[model samples]
Target: MEIGEDYRDAVLPQSRWEKRKFVRCDFTEADLRGLVTQGCTFEECDFTRTDLGESKHDSTAFRSCVFDRTVLAEITWTGCSLLGSSFVDCRLRKIKVRETDFTLVSLGRADLRQCELSGLRFREANLVEANLSGARLRDTDLRAARLLGTDLSETDLRGAKLDADALVQAKFTGARVDLDTAIAFAAAHGLIISS
Candidate 1:
């Protein structure tokens, strides 16, 4: 069912939003925990500071959405599309984002610790100052992605594809990688890894 086409601060929680559509809606500070949605669409929506933890979403599409400081911990989002979305200072720990498209998304200062983001595409996305410590990014593509001041300490980067320029510009202090990846990164910086 479609509701709140252009409303602000609407409280919609613990409801099933199957095949629903929301346009220019604002759910700021709303408690949406344990919400279930499937094939839902949100355009230019604002979910700033919303409590969306433990929510389950499948095939949901969001275009130009803002989730600034939203609590999305333990959320399950599968087959979702978040194009041009911004998630500033949001809590994203333990969130499952499988088969999702986050093209051009901005995750400025988001908490993504311990999240498993394997094989995900982060082309041109911004993750500045975000906490990715202990996160598993195996085979994740970070081409042209901005990771300046990103906290990748102790994070696993096995098979993660990074752009030469972006990787050099990012901060990976104390981050962990396999020997092959380490050698590759060293070679990119004109350093020879001699045995």
Candidate 2:
């Protein structure tokens, strides 16, 4: 479908979209729960309050899109590129992101509780005030990311690559990390980790 030429509201929910391109489209209040998309591209699209929960995406690319108050919980994304996308006040609970690159994405104030984000690349992403409680971040890259006021409580950071500066700038109360990471964090703060 050629829905990228102009701005329009896409109300297609629970639809199967494959290899389609959507540019500058608005999906406000659209019911997209359980929608399946493969090899689709979304550029500069708006997804305000759109229900995309339980959606399945494979090899999809979302660039410079804005997602506000969107229901993206339990969504499964594989081989997706979310470069430069912004998510505000969106539900991301239980979302499975496999081999996805979120470079330069802004997830500020997004709820990512219990999400499996293992081995995902979040380089230069803005995560200010985002909730990541109980999320699995094993081997995730957080290089040069903004994390002020972000919640990492009960979140696993084993094998996660986060610089000392990034760790210091973020809130880590009750966050679970490996002993090596804990010692590194303590050492960065000039505190001695005792055996």
Candidate 3:
């Protein structure tokens, strides 16, 4: 267990950590590229300006963590839980996620364009103004997620589980959706769909 430790500007690349717990740790400006962690828990940790590119995590929990200006490109997460985490201005290009839970997480104004986010859970997440253009969200769960001003342009929302309120709140210009979703959107906007 590492609590309240300051690892700012530290270089720890390609490290393997398993079943470790980090609480309130500061990883500002650190280089942790290609790191692998499994079943690890990070609570209230700050990852400001940290480069975590190509990191692989499985079954890890990042509760209430802050990722400000963090480089998370090419990261792979499987069965991980990011509950209550907040991402601000982070670099998330080419990130891969599988069965990850993002419940209550905040991703306001984050750019996740063209990312493959299929089958992930975003229940009650705050995604206001987030850019999800061209992302693949097939079979994803987004129930109760805040979509105010969220860009779903050219994004695929087929088979996604979301409420009618979410459809009416998000921007869906040029988005691909199934017939059920389209009908729901129309109903949410008070449009009479006969046929």
Candidate lDDT (C-alpha), each: 0.82, 0.86, 0.95
User: TM-scores of all models?
Assistant: 0.88, 0.88, 0.96
Best by TM-score: 3
lDDT of candidate 1 over 1-195, digit per residue (tens):
344454445577787888988888878888888999999999888998989999999999988999988899899989898989998878787899888877789987888888988778888889888888888888787878888888887787888877766556666777777776677778878896667
CA lDDT for candidate 3: 0.95
- Give residue 181's error in model 3 in angstroms: 1.0
Question: 1-195, model 3: which lDDT tens digit per residue?
Answer: 999999999999999999999999999999999999999999999999999999999999999999999999999999999999999999999999998999999999999999899889999999999999999999899999999999999999999988887888899999898989988988999999887
Model 3 residue 69 CA deviation in Å: 0.5
Once fitted onto the true fold, the runs of candidate 3 whose alpha carbons sit more than 4 angstroms away are: none
TM-score of 2: 0.88
Q: How does model 3 score by TM-score?
A: 0.96
lDDT of 2 by residue, 66-131 (tens): 889889888999999999999888878778889999999999887887788989999999998888
Q: Candidate 2: lDDT of 168?
A: 82
User: How far is 117's C-alpha from truth in model 2 (Å)?
Assistant: 1.3
User: Which wins on lDDT, candidate 1 or candidate 3?
Assistant: 3
Runs in model 2 lying further than 4 Å from the true structure: 1-9, 192-195
